[model samples]
Target: MRSLCLLFVTAAALSGCASVRTHQGYLTDPQLVASVQPGVDNRASVERALGRPTFMGQFDNNDWYYVGRELAQVAFGNPKPKEGTMLHVRFDPAGNVATAENLGLTRVVSIHPVGDKTPTLGRNRNFFEDLFGNIGQVGSVGQGGGTADNPTGGSGSN
Candidate 1:
């Protein structure tokens, strides 16, 4: 009886171990997705089957979005992706399916590139001048103190 109980407890504990989940959260079944006729599957029907979208673009109103994000909650930790799926549904002028693109992690493009500089048209200004220009007497050639000739507000101690 003792041996049997030990075996049962071990089996139970082993069965309780967490198994990583895959292919259940995002990215609907490829076969099922392929079966969906773009225009035939109305907006409400998709929502009923696939829940809410992750996001909806404003300027590009034609495209509807569905996103999944995962971040680690612990401090001093590395966050890993739990599950992410993107469904970009594009509609034509007649409200027909222009395309239903399933973009996954492989398809995602990092908008932030390394050493990427913001495009600028105007000339750059002096950094110190731009930062501390207004802190002190900027008009006095940036020199400390002022001459007696101009005493309106040279001391800067109003």
Candidate 2:
């Protein structure tokens, strides 16, 4: 009975560490993707064959993109991309397919931030400087004959 209980506890603990895979965006079909031919397939036919694109180009409407990614995550960690595919289709002025290209995971980029705070060129300030830095600098009566109302550094007309 103790052995069986131990086995159950071990299984439960191990299950939490198992990796989970998720597929996002377009489901790729190699045969349908290969069938799309430049100069032969137009916008309408491509849409019929592959359905709507994942997204269109931000700058140009003639470019279409079909993106797919598979991410794997273990436990409570962040999901990382395991596989990625991007299909780019460009259209000519006459709406004919100008080019079709497939991009792979080589284009994926992972960035890790250096620290919690972003680096800046200016000098660093402590808690006291940040709290009391602007004490007498603002709204003083006559540091240089300038008040909050008359900030031109000269006498007021009144």
Candidate 3:
């Protein structure tokens, strides 16, 4: 009997869990924010209007992003958001409504960060210095005969 009680207690404890929370970034309740239009949505005013954003985006200080997510853990936890109709809204440079767009999860593509596209060049290397690395001594580059066997056009040896 004690073992059975303990088993029930253990099961109950195990069942209790912290629900996964997905912050709806950058989004305000649409109806709430929609009612706040056209009166100069400057940073402070907008914040006063929409509270705060979920996260800031890359290469943009003027834009705000709000994200609403579906909770897979529990029913009545969050709206499934109309399948793909997740709400995403963007603010304009002047802090007013730029545009509001809805993205369906079906159309949502995962983004992978590939790091900086520009190959890291020496910061101190001036333009002429960079030219030295790739362009070489004014006219030495590309002068050598082109062939896989003789990439630099030497006598088949270094």
For candidate 1, the lDDT comes to 0.62
Ranking by lDDT: 2, 1, 3
lDDT of 1 by residue, 3-93 (tens): 9999999988766553534343355556645654686775665666566666666987667776654433333344446556677877776
lDDT of every model, 2 decimals? 0.62, 0.90, 0.56
lDDT of 3: 0.56
| Position 83, candidate 1: lDDT | 53
Per-residue CA lDDT of candidate 3, range 90-133, in tens? 66766666554555566567666787665774355667765665
> Mind sharing the TM-score for model 1?
0.44
The weakest ten consecutive residues by lDDT in model 1 span: 69-78
> Better model by lDDT, 1 or 2?
2
Question: On residues 1-158, what C-alpha lDDT tens digit does candidate 2 reach at each position?
Answer: 99999999999999999999999999899999999999899999999999999999999989999999999999999999999999999999899999999998887687889889988876588999879876776746456745444566666565
* Best candidate (score: TM-score): 2
Pairs in clash, predicted candidate 2: none
Name model 3 segments beyond 4 Å from true.
1-28, 38-40, 74-92, 102-107, 111-158
